[model samples]
Target chain A: MTVSLEQARIIIAQTFKKGSELGLKPLSVVVLDAGGHVQAFEREDGAAPGRFAIAHGKAYGAVMLGMAGRAQMARAEAQAYFMSAVNGAFGGAVVPVPGGILLRDDQDAVIGAVGITGDTSDNDVLAGLAGIAAAGLKAEA
Target chain B: MTVSLEQARIIIAQTFKKGSELGLKPLSVVVLDAGGHVQAFEREDGAAPGRFAIAHGKAYGAVMLGMAGRAQMARAEAQAYFMSAVNGAFGGAVVPVPGGILLRDDQDAVIGAVGITGDTSDNDVLAGLAGIAAAGLKAEA
Candidate 1:
């Protein structure tokens, strides 16, 4: 079960739409396929200079962690040093933030993920999850 | 005219299809907009490791050079030191390979580029050019 390009477009579009509807800032959204390759990505005009990198990092990180979004946040917080090590190990590919979310297909298998940046972490999570739901997928958690 | 994600997908799909029809190996492909940002990318199952980097470098080099595909090879041959400096400056993002081609719109303006890896450079270029044509776009020269 791979994340299709159409689904990736929906994920990116709906992520920004939800962010705007919720008064979040312009966003950079990234969707990665199960293979960790970028399926589709977009950086809205006026998005922060480095938002795309942050967004991609978050999604890559979430997928590499093999768990849903921030379900491991508490664990990461308790082991900050280990988390730092993971970041170093991945070469900054993982952001370990709320905006990164693991997505599941109908079979409930981890297929890929959506990552958003340019807004507060909480709002970024809201938009990312909303976008996944809009695409008829579930956020693994 | 920017290369939309839909167009990028078409290019990638047709490139892989062409490669298969020619009995070539599995491949990794990348499409970058004029800004050198990834619009879409794919890595076929069983593609060799490091294919993605090579593919991306090819596309990045094509777009950055503002020429069509391997058309710059002749210029590079005349100025080996200059071309070597370019490759070093771009940190290997600029590959002087045949597999990268600049995409052009109806007005013959460059909009993006496609890069493919995993097969011979000649076969990769054939697939890349075919994919661009399949998307109803031109390969700028």
Candidate 2:
């Protein structure tokens, strides 16, 4: 019933390693357990300072809604009023955008999520998906 | 993987309802998506002034570690030297204790987490579990 922190750390480390292997810039990688809690997080050296929290925020937003943040961007654009209302409703917790991906088990249930920053939003999303896959989890397209 | 403001409000409401039904004191409930970012949070009317932030910090720590904050007490105790060195790691994010629980789906994937304050640790954990359950998610033991 518990998501092992050690495993999470290992997965995060692997994620960073993958990022390095890809010759990408330093990244902040974050992992969250199914309950939408942080399982393990690491901000690579030289990565932007605020990217850590921003990546976390983006990923958290995605997991809560069971969709990608980027998908919500269109909704936000069409419903600015509703989006603004969400900002007030969550006291500023909502941030529907990309750079995050949900982690799923073999059974296809969302078990956790990964988020990455310190690169383009597209890059972040790719990195997050790679990290989840490295951990032997799947990501919904 | 975003945690919408609406989801946050729903989680908080569930947490407060569980507390009131049990005749507990007013509580502050915080929901964080996977990646250790705040999603939605609320402190019941008449709750302690600082309980909101404190509960959030603790929940952030819990989710980041993918375990209950209470569970991290031992690690924190044994790794005092290291813990102190990173005392403000994650910008004061490590709550490493039992007052929170991770949110997981049917396959045991972590989607988010909830933390509760204004009651005993046992009560807080109970309230969090109730909130996760209310959301139709499973809580790690």
Candidate 3:
């Protein structure tokens, strides 16, 4: 099943809460359903305008490719031209970055994804994991 | 000044609040800076997957053209070819419709725009106006 609105809201809220506890910069979070459609989003007050698009692209790429962001990052490095073409094909929605995390069901099926931005990519991933945990969901390891 | 993320959140929150008060269908709301960058966006749980894109297009059009959605609709009808060309120029971000509204400051300077979708266009406009009003912002009349 796809992520419900209530779950998406929880994901966003916990993502921000984690970011704040870590004393990171203002963050932007986006939750997308299996089809890569936005379900919910939030940008912290001091976050830059572009954070939403960046977070969206990251999560969209993860959900659309059925691959975690870290794997996509490796592939992007090894196949620059292919990754570039894919990015163009998706109208710049696929961002091969570390902050995109895939949400999975108990059956290991991807149900949605979370993307976080406005801090280091690793920190973003940490926050994303916290959000997924808060929602009682699984994230691709 | 540009629309802060706080204001953008209020606009989206109040837009959905008004939509619920009116018993409208699930809605998607998008807030954009005057430069047409997305500041905040949300789609209700039952909203169609494409609602976010549609709402974003409407608000982006209003902000980019410096005109209200009603005026844009009239121009779009009278000059279909021009409107088509403009839509292409903006990568399909322009949607001339009633739900798009320009947000203005105390001095009447355009600050941003809001777009709502998933209900009747007229109802969407009403919801958007309520949102802008709640945010203490002016709408281009």
The candidate that achieves the highest TM-score relative to the unseen native structure: 3
Better model by DockQ: candidate 2 vs candidate 3: 3
lDDT winner between 2 and 3, please give it.
3
Instruction: Quote each prediction's TM-score.
Output: 0.70, 0.49, 0.94
- CAPRI grade, predicted model 2: incorrect
- What clash pairs does model 3 have? none
Report the C-alpha lDDT of model 3 over A1-141, residue by residue, as the tens digit. Answer: 899888988888898899999999999999999899998888887787788889998899999999888988999999999889999999887989899999999998999998899999999999889989999999972
lDDT (tens digit, per residue) of candidate 3 on B23-140: 9999999888877777778898888899988898889899998988899889888999988998999888788988999999999889999989999999999998998899999986
For the predicted complex of model 3, DockQ is: 0.66
Ranking by DockQ: 3, 1, 2
Alpha-carbon runs more than 4 Å astray in model 3: none
Q: Residues B12-112, candidate 1: write the lDDT tens digits.
A: 88998899999999877888887777666676766654576788888888888887557766667888788789889988578776788898887777888
Off by over 4 Å in 2: A1-3, B1-141
lDDT digits (tens) for residues A42-75 of candidate 2: 5654554356567667767667767666776777
Better of 1 and 2 by lDDT: 1
Tens-place lDDT digits, model 2, residues B1-141: 434445555666687788999888878777777766655445554565466456776777666767666666667788876655554767665656667677776666677677778888788878777776766677763
Off by over 4 Å in 1: A1-52, A67-86, A103-138, B72-82
Every candidate's lDDT: 0.78, 0.66, 0.89
Best by DockQ: 3
Question: Candidate 2 — what's its lDDT?
Answer: 0.66
Output the worst ten-in-a-row residue range by lDDT, candidate 2 chain A.
A1-10
- By summed lDDT, which 10 consecutive residues of candidate 3 chain B come out lowest? B32-41
